[model samples]
Target: MKKSLLALTVISTLLPLAACQTASNQVATAQTAEIDDKSEALKLNELTQQYFEASLARNPLMATFVGVHQYDDKFNPPLSAEFIQETRAFEQAYLDKVNQLDASELTGQDWLSYEIFKYDRQHALAGMDFNQEYMPLSQMGGAHTYFAMLGSGQSAQPFNSTQDYREFMQRARGFAEFMDSTIIFMQKGVESGVVLPRPIAEKVLPQLSSHVVEDITQSVFYAPLTKLDSLENLTSEEKSTLQQDYVAVIRDVIIPAYDRVYQYMKNDYLAGTRSTVGLSALPDGNEWYEHKIQTHTTLPLTAEEIHAFGQREVKRILEQMTKVKDQVGFQGDLQEFFVHLRTSDEFYFDSEEEVIEAYTKVKQKIDTRLPALFSVFPKADYEVRAVEPFRAASAAGASYQAPAPDGSRPGIFYINTHNLKAQPKFLLETLSIHEAAPGHHFQIAIQQEVEGLPQFRKFNNYTVFAEGWALYAESLGKEMGMFEDPYQWYGRLVDEQLRAMRLVVDTGLHAMGWSRQQAIVFMLNNSSMSETDVVAEVERYISIPGQALAYKIGERHIRELREYAEDQLGDKFDIRAFHQQVLVDGGIPMPLLTEKIQRWVASQR
Candidate 1:
């Protein structure tokens, strides 16, 4: 699944030089022609503005996620024939207009802007045939997590206002139709063998049923109203009216809507769900799997090639892991040491608060060393928070939610505490580096804060580039004077091995026909991760094809780029400036990213 698009016959790949146009002539022409570059920049900005407005008009839930409130009460229409047709037309128009622009005429930030903008537009169009909606609402992609976000009273949805309450009621009405459509899609999955695994289906039933309660006041969605009284501007009378309306919406609409979907899954869907391992089992599985690879990597590597690479990486990381064994003075072979890390108390936190604190300490430690590695830093402040109780069971060991670009909220690094054993103290430094400080927070915040780049470039993501950079940041621990503690250093290697394992286990499960249990066994045998972690990671691979491959593959590319730059530039190379160049322009595809770095290296020379 993590393989390149060229590996499958679904889409054609373009040469890098052909896909990109030169900017020098365009820059000079813009300097003296009918308009200045700033005016040309506005065209891209206007397109972004139009795009966002169109998206909000179509999908209100997406609006809420981005801190846009006007659409808080609406859900986007179901993925249907009409939706697909309209989206295709929109993308085609944008691509046609973008191609007309002379990108070679632009330079500096403008050139970076042109490249990223064109890439995303083309990439979005590339996966048109995949039909993501065909197999949506799994344990991973369900709206269940999103509903919890709104109910938490801490996100963008306003619970204190009457208008907000009224719009939410409207949303409840909209959701009923969405659930119906989701069931239709799931039913289609049943027919196509694209259904969720039996284990995951059983795991998700409870979560869906939790929202099916008859009383709105008792629902998780009602927690916002319980906190409404604390808002200073809300008078008791206004609060009462809002609360009453919210309850009606939930009782009369939302609960029943949730109930309908829950009943369908419990009674009808579960019995028919698939027990298969990969996307290859689905209709046109080859094409869909290929699309996922291209979408994630933004490159043209084949599945067989990726599978072979994963085999090599896993072997490589395991060898590095032996050094961890020696450093810690463990008295056994690697497997036995992995067992000790699993069973031993020295590697784990006594409480969830301790997990949070470990990450906090890592942030402080990494902050002092960041200057040594690079000059660029994100302006937005970030905080570490525990993953909310309900979702933590299935959440990643740690994940990041980027702050709203408008500065309405701070970036949050959510550390999962559901299974304490999985959140070992040994992994804190690497986890913190990858998820917070120099990892996602730095990359995402710096991208958002970058000026003179097209708006799309600011938010668009490439898995190889984004996740790879985060994984590579973990290697900075030694440079930052960390990993000095042999056990902690082992944590770094273990984390690296986990990514490497993804390459092996993911391809093994999807491409090589390994069962879910087989994939878990492969990870358990290779790494020091907990059994719970092994199961979760294996399931995650199943739920999201090709996503697992991005972490290590991307990290490897960034490392290679750094090594190449150091070798090429020699005395002229500046690590801080290299970092600045990487972060200042936001995320790019690995190939294009390398080109930009080479340009910067040349500029320094």
Candidate 2:
């Protein structure tokens, strides 16, 4: 890996170092440089290990996700003034050390390592002024929601033994302090003009109420103890002891912690949330938003530029939809055809299992065709599961969770059956390709399986790279001969139009000062999405700014790169190598991706 970084070393060797005229001087310089490089590389690797270990210690829920059990006994305390300052200092020192590393001397995996470290440090430093903790917990999306998932055995939290039970109790006990701090953070947010939009917060109230059962034993979270019979090697006495300990922790620690937060939100924060929309309305709002765009897309595009580009794309996609409308023998224009599809009985699935089965079929077909496009594939297996009910209402239509690096858990593609209408059968094949087969499951798993990449590169993700590839995969319907049916073709266009609408709606809400209602209306006008789907999608854009930009932006980049390769390589271009070049590097900023692809092109030449 280190030698790969120095593929340019021989080129450097031929350059003049005018002062090193003597043989003895050159030998001494070369020997000293070798020792120094090794020393620095070892020091940096140690720092990486230290940081990774500390991160797990600070967030035990994260530890469980990565299959590390040592820190299962603690939860991260809510952000405090002390925490904010210390983290800033920690990142600052880490950045200083990274700046000292000689990246030019590194190659391949080492070069990748240098880039990941630099990018992570620089971005953290860039956001230090944003003060995101002021809105530490939102009813719409925040730590409170994430922690509830942890307590549910279906997630990363363990429920197998007396020791695991005891560990959870210790973690749950910290909830009161965390909730108290959450309130303080939201209170600061209200004073600082960083409140969440009212429409989104109103929707969150129902979810909050659902989670606030008066009896801890009656809560959805209690399913863990009820399902304990599935746990291996546990005797009745141990199970009884674990069950009692869990109920006590939930009743005494967890429930009260939720109640404290619920009351604070109801009494204080809810009333103070802004009736208006947009992050642009907040303090230092423009710059804060620009950072979000750059962070998500890993590109230097301004929101205004993305907004303009979205308008162009919306126009192009709508034209494509018109062609599909004619092919489907729809009697009306594109807009009318959209309305028909949304209300059409044939498009809807009778049950969630049908939707799953449809996707499974897509997977089988796509898997066979994949060999034509690429030589490499993910080693681990993957499965399709319905998104858990508790958070499904707010989750994306279909999302992918990468496998554990050690492969203890298979990758999971969560299909949101929360709204059956949203998961139309027409879109099943496309969605499967996006969230599973050649999309996230393959890309992320292949990256993790890479032998020599740094740990950070394996786990790290750039939203544009990840989401973009998924969106691009959706466009592969024609290539795979799966969009032969006009209805399925329309489904692909509908999904494509949805991404185009996101570009418009997301920029509308965050940049042009559109209300939540306006964003929903725009989506309905342009795409074949139901009102229920439109409302949920708009609220998602509200909670997560600039994230929508990545899909379309990334797809454009990947498609353009493929075109460039075809133009440059002419008959020499290999689809397999093109795919390998893209997926082999995992996720990178689009510019770095271009360079990597160009490097591959040069090698072929």
Candidate 3:
């Protein structure tokens, strides 16, 4: 979620001493004030570095993902009471120190960095007020899911040497302890009346139970041992020893840990899960959902405003769908056309490889035309792959994982082929554009490679800018000459409709007290989505409120900014330069992004 960086929570309010004295005294006082400003700026920079370091130390998984190896063998610090209090104190102390500085004295990127740091700290503190730690794991993401990926030898954790094998064994120990701690947190959730919806809890059971295999060789935890032969540094004897140790950990520590969580979810947690779908049903849930909306959208919009906006967008896109239906010479209403698109065998693929191949071709077509629109491209390349089977059934249609800062890993676009019928052929071009080329891969990889920015700016994400930019990227399919067929053009409209629908369904479920079935029915009536896809998406909103709102909200802002720039500059407006200006600052809150872009527009005049 993004938060406002322009709202400086702390500014010095004290007035300077009297200037009516002798001119010499006044001049001396002025010099002292100037020195104080520089000294404060220096202190703020030092504090930013310190806060980043503390953040990495507290989150070892984040450290490993960013290419920092020092914490590779450790799990994240336990979410115990003591750790929470200490973290609160740490943020408060930094907030106090940063608030004393005068922003008027800072200039250029230094000032920008200060705003980001302050926004980050204050946002972190605000989130601490929520009891999110109590409901730790979810169907969406948590230690239960991510740990399996990390241990699989196919994720960020490397498995190249004897030392690497040993480090994982230590990590496996930490995993066991972490699992126990998470169960304790879930128990706390029960007492506090904070619980997952029954549907979400049911989804989590299969995810945990998937890892409880009878054979050690089949366990994802034992994946590294299977690949030991590929590591040239490990001798045959060392490989044999590591294999024995790996099996022992999976058999004794890892498998049992999963079984424990599975049993708990099935026996105790399921019965107590919430019956109502909306966050507003829970204690303080309305306030929490409001905060989520602000965080994800980085705006002060109310639920009612977002819901109404979504309704208007959905109606407009449906009208566009009608034009496409008539152009294709279909013989029925919009709903019938949707059913034809959903159920027709001609629109579906037979195999997962065929789906991957279709996206590969789309990439080829889009790459040749990118130079016409973007002057700045990422040096880090990207690859398309299937979402690993373990989580595919529950995963979104398509998602991207950013490249590593050190270039050890390229960015990945995970296309979910779990249900072929759910992935229509016509949708490939827009999905490819949004997830692979100019969407996440381009925005994220460029941010990673940006020079001279703080590490946070380079790697952190603002959901509105990131998801919004991706949604906006889908519109470029028409400009790039790929959506030539009317049906393919309809695919782009379908994509827009999904985002617009999110505004309605997410707010409807979480804010307006709409039931899960009601939201699903609303989506099915408006779009050509499969029942499977609609169900999955609605459940996602149920689990994570207000997150889906970022897409349309963000796209609307970026499109508005472009229109403003074009109107102001007229024939002088360069699309390439406008895009570069948006991406050069990396992911930031929309308010800050708006200010920076307005400045650019004024300068161009």
Candidate 4:
């Protein structure tokens, strides 16, 4: 953006030209040019707003997630063919328009915004090449799974109002239709030979049937009805009427929809599904996985390349773990150490309450220590709580949900205490830091609150940046003056190995044609994860190809950037400022993040 100076000094030859114009006229001309620049910038802003509105319309659930409630009642047609066609056209149109903007005239955030907007459209358009609709619902996550959470009234969907209840009822109908469409899509997959793996389909069977309760009140969908009495504005008659409608919808529409998918999954789809777990089992499967790698990591890394990186990372992390084990004076080799860590009651809790209490303490301890490493903190404080029972089995041991942008809801750091042993006490420090403060909560809540960025920039995620930062956050425990316990340091290594192994196992399952059991065994051999949790994690990779690679790959790049900063800046390096610069812009692409850091380091020098 640097401009060459064109001297406008007076000279003997220019005397006549200078005499032609008055000072007032020159000022007026300059003022008009400045006005024109402002107008052009405003024009660009208007286009981004238009793009934001269309994006919200296309993904209503996303709107609710970020506290935009206008689309709370809606659902995108659950990956129907027509919806896909519309999405393609929508992205193409915006991409064309964005490409038409004059890049030379834009600078600062406006220029950055234009570049990211164009990149997003291009990335999304490229994704349209894959037939992801064929495999709609997975035990890992899908509309049906998220809708269950919303219906439970414990998620982003607000249930305090009569309108909120009615909107959910409306969503129940949309969900049923969505399930019907999902079946049709799967049927298309069956015809096209792009079906889910048999084992993943099996895992989903119980998830579907679990929703079909004999008593309406017992249903997860009935949670709102239970809260109707809390709506003090509602008359007794209105509350009773609302309760009836809620139950009726759950019984007639919702439960039947669950059963329909269940029946299809159990009877029709399971038989139709392929026994092979990898995407390579289907047509153009390898390319589909490559696209997923690009999508999740925002890098053009192939499966093999990622797998190689993962293998090296696994070796490096294992060496670090060995040092920890030796420090602890363990007599066994690394694998034996893993077994001892996994089996020993000395490191586990028998009760869910005890596990929750332990995690809460981790949160409390980390909160006080955060300022040592982080200068910025989230305004919306997060809570440490146990994961809800319904999704707990499939969920990771710990996960984070960002706070509502409008401050209506706090960020939730969910600890899945379903298997108490799986929630090992030693892993508490690293896990809490990853899922709560100075990690997901800090990156996401701060991103949501950052002003002057486009709405998409504020809310959109390039997950490599998000999960990568969280994983990187876990590595910060030592700098924060934590990990005094060798076991806690081992826990850090365990989590890092998990991310590293993801690069191996995700590619192994999808690209190298490794079976589900092979991936599970590889994870079990390398890490101390319980068999039950290992299976769930392996299935998660199978269900969502290439996503798991994000954490490790992203963390690696960010750490490299940080190390580069430290090496270059040396005594001048401010750890707090380096973090601020990395996160000042929300989760951006890896290359862009690299460029931003390189530029910052130069500025500091």
Candidate 5:
């Protein structure tokens, strides 16, 4: 599962104020409390800022993406023993400092920040207790993939200045060092039973080898050199020198670094990798998976519970699909209709342009319709883009990138056109709505734009909130008066079934002793998803345990809250205001979100 920068835990309790002996004494007590609260809030705010700045400095790549440029030149190898120890120390020291503050007097945003900070610190320390650095990189993601994306010239790393060029060079050197560190860890993993699965290692080989090139210009790392004209002050000699630096790095540093890891992975690491695919295969893997489930869902849920819930959800969705199947007057049974949907070219896009145009249409239509259900829309609009070619095949069918806080970059909804079968035509409306407007774009951009919120709350992502909200947004299509065609409605069920299936498949892979094929077959049997899409999705869950559960787990919670709102408020419920209540706080934990909504519902009553 994808995680944001921060985690929240523990709600604060109000400190009991002094009992007044008389009216004058009451006034005196109130005055003293006000002064104390102000002082405490100021200290809390300062500590949050201090922590944020320190966090940025520690994770320079994150800083670069978040528009903090001071750390643009700094690159830290995240997997190094020294880095992990330092990070643990950093979080602990700040956590101790935060604990010293008087949260009793803090209220409103101040109180929320204090609580989120404490949770973020404590939860982070808890998660860090796992030996994650041992199995760091996956074909799905890691420093290797992120580093490649940064070098591609299309990512957040800016290649706009001479300083930028030099900084990237420094980053490249750090990457080389990172490769060495990765090898050290993998060797450690080999000695222990903590290695990547054999299949995962096999998949990573091509990705790593793609970076190693005999010709320097073919290197993804050499992409920045092509755009040197964008640099203003550089003379021909300066440009020539920068070009040489890039070539040298690609030839001597970057490519060799890739080759070293690629060779090791192919020859050495592959043999050491586990034949069994699940986290259960490794030592303490079940504990790690359990922690991941709690961390991602931000609820005390088990694999068994989520798996059973997923089965119920799947059955419910299938019943709806049956109704749609009969409504569409399909000639066959539900399974046959699923096969028809998967096989029919009418449901698949012919070309990438057609797909992008379809999403563009969705953007135009959904943007106008949003006002009916929402009072708050992001100030930043999102663009629909193809996943870059290098990563497209392995990337998710579609994903969203949040817009820059200062409005420098628009949110990007990446549609993977690499596998057109994965982007079925009937599912376009639901997919676009979920990945773009009122989904990730609204949730993320709005989070970034939430006024006076601390940095962590603004940027820290909760997978359950983010993914769940997106899945919930997909359901709003019927409310928006789209999906009138039964096939389109079936498309929504298909999308939902994908998430519901995740709950079962994720748990199955980690906890149920499932083979990779068994997970794939189970998903194919359960949903109308193309085998291509099912394979990718199952592999993704295998790579990252407990992440896929976030969508349904989160969606169900938010939807339940909405249903509760509608039931309790009756005719008085305001959909727009309820959405604002859910979203305006940005990404909150499920319990916090429920409490917030209940509080809103009570106020409305």
Candidate 6:
């Protein structure tokens, strides 16, 4: 899936420096000139705001999601070959403009913003070399899924007034155009051998077919009509007109477009899709995989290095699991113990409601204890919801959606109940901590509430920092007094082991040429994850390479920084203050985060 547009807004907030001169004497004069740092900072901030406005003008859906309503009726053209080329060229121009700035002349947050802006442009430009546009749709996340969510009346798209409904009608037209363009891209993918894996293609067919209902009212796209009665701003006549327009759009534009995608996928694309699961099977696969690794982890480690690290982590975690088993006095070897954990009726929930209720209870317990660990808390509150049935079969065990910037929407922690057995009761505490309180909700909401930062900083996410912090939050279960039961402690171990296995499995599949089955077998042999969960995770890695590596790698860096602070400060160490320092600046690259902590440590001394 693409990062949230709110996250991608970093590209829009970059300030371009004055054009550079080629002459040596002019260059020396420019370099030597006394620049007013404060004046330049003001100029930079103004430029960033202007750029953000320009970006919102072009990306309508993004503007809507971020609470900028001016462009809510617009949508970008399809990702056609020409569109991709144009976008790359545009990014390169901005990159060149920013490159003219001297980082040494900036200070504090001004310098931080400059570095972030440069990083965003350069990373985006580099990715343009890969043919990601060709394979635009995936079972993991794609236009098909996101459009359904937006039209479902339960997502970021607002449906509060008649104008909102009318704007979405225009958006529905744009969605049809977008789907047509997707078909074009898939055709190009077929010719270039840049198609999705066969399994993913298979999964996508059912998703598309689900939307092809005979009755217009049954369509997810027709959901707005059902909601018209709730809009007090609309007249009875206006509501009737809106309902008629919705029916016409859903019957003529939306469903037909979905049918087009469905027919093409079932008849043409599936035959061309690759059976090989690894990215290494594609053209320039090695370079593509390497870029993803660096992009996701923001670290210099190679596939081989990450694989070796994962091996060591797996071994160490197994030892911890053995101790847990011994303490519980379970008979049989570790493999048998895994079976016991999987099959025991006690570990499984009877219903989806039970699973949600379990998480709610965990949240209530953790809420009281959070004050001891953090000095800062988000003004935004969060709630837990079960994953929607349409996508839950292929979704992660759990995932988080950050709260809206305007606080109109709360952060959501979606627990997948596709296979309840995959969600063991022992895993509930650790999962709750990671996805909810003091995890994504805490970190992301705090970032949104941060004052004086650029909009990009408030909304942007680095996978390593975000996912890593969540994993680090899981370790806080011990400090928060929630892991008293030996079984719950074992849940923490199992969770950690999952991350450890990701490091190995992600590398194994992408770099080492391991098959999908090989990766699944490796995970099952090493951890207590169900075969159902293991298969989903392995396929997830296959679908999105190198993303899985961020968790353990990010947690390791965070834990190391915390340990360094403690070792240096001794009795003066304040966990709350340390957490505040880490979170106050919002999500950043791992190296920058380390530097920020090191500076804090120095000031304390």
Give all TM-scores, in the order shown: 0.90, 0.91, 0.93, 0.92, 0.92, 0.93
lDDT of 5 by residue, 478-533 (tens): 88877887777888898899889899889999988999999999988888888888
- Model 3 score (lDDT): 0.79
Evaluate model 2: give its TM-score: 0.91
Worst 10 residues of 6 by lDDT: 13-22
> How does model 3 score by TM-score?
0.93
Candidate 2 residue pairs in backbone clash:
4-107, 5-106, 5-107
User: How do the candidates rank by lDDT, highest first?
Assistant: 6, 3, 4, 5, 2, 1
Candidate 2 achieves a global lDDT of 0.73
- lDDT score, candidate 4: 0.79
Candidate 1 positional error at 287, Å: 2.1
**Model 1 segments more than 4 A misplaced:** 1-42, 214-218
Q: Which is the better candidate, 1 or 4, if ranked by lDDT? A: 4
Give per-residue CA lDDT, model 3, range 441-537, as digits (tens).
8888888798987776776767788889988988877777779988788889998999999999999998899999999999999999999999989
Worst-scoring 10-residue span by lDDT in model 2: 1-10
The sequence of per-residue lDDT tens digits that candidate 4 reaches over residues 1-605 is 00000000001001111111123233433433343334456756766776676566556666677678887787544545556665666666667767767888887677667777888889877776877778877776666677787788888889989999888888778778878988898999999998999888888887888898998878888877777778877799898898888889999999999999899888898889898999888899888888889877998788889999999999999999999999999998988998899899999998888887888888888888888877877788888778788877666677777778888888887888888878888888998888777888899889888888788788777778888898899999998878999999989999899999999999999999899889999999888899998888888888878779889889989999999999999999999999999887887899888878888899999
Which parts of model 3 are misplaced by more than 4 Å? 1-42
Model 4 regions more than 4 Å off: 1-40
Tens digits of per-residue lDDT for model 2, 422-454: 888888777788878888788878988987665
